[model samples]
Target: MSNSNAERETWSTRIGFILAAVGSAVGLGNIWRFPFQVGQEGGAAFIVMYLAFVVLIGFPAMMVEFVVGRSTGLNAVGGIREFAGGAWKYLGGLFVFIGFVILSYYSVVGGWVLRYVFGSATGGYIGTAGPDEAPVAQQYFFDIASGLDALLFHALFMALVVLIVALGIKRGIELGVKIMVPAIIAIFAILAVYASTLSGAGEAYAYYLSPDLGYLIDNWKSIVPAAAGQGFFTLSLGMGVMITYASYLSEDENLGIDGGTIVAFNTGISILTGLIVFPILFSAGVSPGDPGAGAIFVSVAEALGDLQFGRAIGVLFFATVAIAALSSAVSLIEVVVSYAIDEFNVPRVRATAIIGTLIFALGIPVTIDPVMVDLYDIFAAKILLVLGGILLVTAVSWIYSDKALAELSKGIGSFSGIGTVWLWTVRVPVLVVLIISLYLGIDSFIDFLAGPFAEFLA
Candidate 1:
């Protein structure tokens, strides 16, 4: 069969694809969610477990998607069907739908980050710290989140994402990622360094780096799923984002090294976020608020509010978040566009415009209602993501294992150290763990909707 991918967009360079993948993976989840998970899950223990998932599961899962997309050289739905046959093509559609659902709420959250950047720039949150911090940050978040301001910023964020996707691979997605990824890293690195200079910095390091074995033992039930979810979430797996991104990669690029690079950069930035956030929060004598939007918009904002050069720090911090948000949003929106272009033969620009506007409209309710955002977010993160992951691995293992391995092994040194492990990873241990992760994710979400939740960290 002729490779349809030959006719589609290709990254101009290997670094472009790697950076774009990293950008997709390292978003609000890394900056906002990872730190809280570390603190809640006994620091180093959670890190160890999460890394195990990455090494044993996450990386292989990623390779599966890459093999599917690159081998078929098509969008998620088309690629799966082309390779796997039967009703399996619909599995790709499911991922596209999940991506749609994710972007609807994700864009709204990105808008919230946008408002924070603006507020930080103008020093609107400067005096809201100390005793009144929580109320001020909460009030500010709710006001901006529900008000027309959210819609405005949401539109702006969406427009930026659409513009990039419409520009094609070489000129647009790859280019934007090249600039955004480095800027995100440099600014965050500077922020982390500055945070380390704070008086209570040692305390922050202890909280962030020290392992609490007792806490791990006590909270193992809660910690397991959180680590599993974070591993998938931080890697941007199970959402068809990687499938579409990998479709653009050429035949010469080695999937193992490229995937590893993306993971390294994405994981490094997440760890850097912890370094920046904990020190500031500790020195300011503020506990990380409950594990939702409060951690970033409220608790961290309060901590930064009292510091010298706080305004500058806040701007830099939120700026880093804004870039991460946009980068990830770009990939999500592109997932939608790629599906349309491949399956429907729609023009990239027109597809992007239509899908981007619709997602923007869909997000309005989420942006307006705090409850809606929370519910939709929980559903996507826990249910859709986890289930998508299970389905993804199953398809790769049963339907197209040999084909995936063939694609992945191309232009590589030797598969001795890697291929056998990656193959069984999809077939056996990884599949079992993903099944468990899905159960845990669903059980957690059920408890979430039950109100005043028990055991599970919200």
Candidate 2:
């Protein structure tokens, strides 16, 4: 309270801040992709990789982000300027710009989730998830995602985001996440418990959790990148989202503890999502299911359709997804709003309105053209985000260097012996991993465009 300013706000409580962080991390990925990956890779082995990734890459990078934001007390752009100075000032703008490009397409995808929510409530996809109707499920997604429907829903989703963020940090983002995060956790916990009671739940559990050291060794090549990427990404690092959020924190707040807490909650929700998913899937007799891009839409939707109370279950799952999507979307848009507030001296409302509208306008193309959506998603996930990760690593390594560590070391053990280890890890190994991942991702995306987009455009 000592450093209070009329122009800025801090989280009302540490708990509220943690909740918002968890909400940001727990997104559509947890519900669908994380669960399927757990099931596919053998739970124990995947969890091993997940924990390793968190410890090695996610934890250190997260603390550096917090240190930068809290020390400088600004959004990504200004924070970098404060910490490093010189040409580095403009470097923060890269993250801000990355956030903008990401949110534009991200909102469109969120709109698609909203459409699914309505469909779930109305049982529109009720029988469409049946084996013979797999094509119907695919068609259902396309039908809602294209043309006018897509545009309207995207607008609706962004409107909700604009409304919340316009309320500013304390009243809007913090309050909203406090409610949404706990509710998401509670609902998924309920689903997990319910799933555990299903007749074939044991089989799902064994498949999801049983240790498979041999499997881990056998598949380490493919598995390492997957776990590392998800671990880093699940924290929403490198987007300026964390930087913006942490900028609202009091310096006395424990960056190390907060980062750990966020990871713990994020991992818990991911596990909860898996427990809920695999059990219900086994009970519903949907097999050959591994968590991937369309896994949740296809398998989860199918399982819900097969259930006795499918209408209610359908509503619950999709509603959970909607909340998760909204939570992340709030962070994405807030990055831009924070940048505008800092850079241009704009009123929060005016900044949000203009930026929100502009981002929504950018999404119109994705709404109209699914091909473009796929392209943007690929570009964002594969290229922009990887580049963002590398940039942060470089910034903390050479740009911020000693200052970043000194900031992190303020009464925190994270800045000491082990912290030095963290520094080198991010500089060499982590940077190497990210760069290689970027190369592989771009290669895969090009192949995808060559194969699928080529046929579709033709």
**Per-prediction TM-score to the true structure, in the order listed:** 0.94, 0.90
Q: CA lDDT, every prediction?
A: 0.81, 0.77
lDDT of 1 by residue, 133-211 (tens): 4566566776788668888888888888899989998888899999999999989988888999998799988877777
| Candidate 2: tens digits of C-alpha lDDT, residues 59-111 | 77787788888888888888877777888777688887777777787787778
Q: Clashing pairs in model 2? A: 36-291
Each candidate: RMSD: 2.9, 3.4
Name the regions of candidate 2 deviating beyond 4 angstroms. Answer: 1-6, 36-48, 128-136, 211-224, 288-292, 369-372, 411-418
Count the clashes in each prediction: 0, 1
Best by TM-score: 1
How far off is residue 4 in model 1, in Å? 4.1
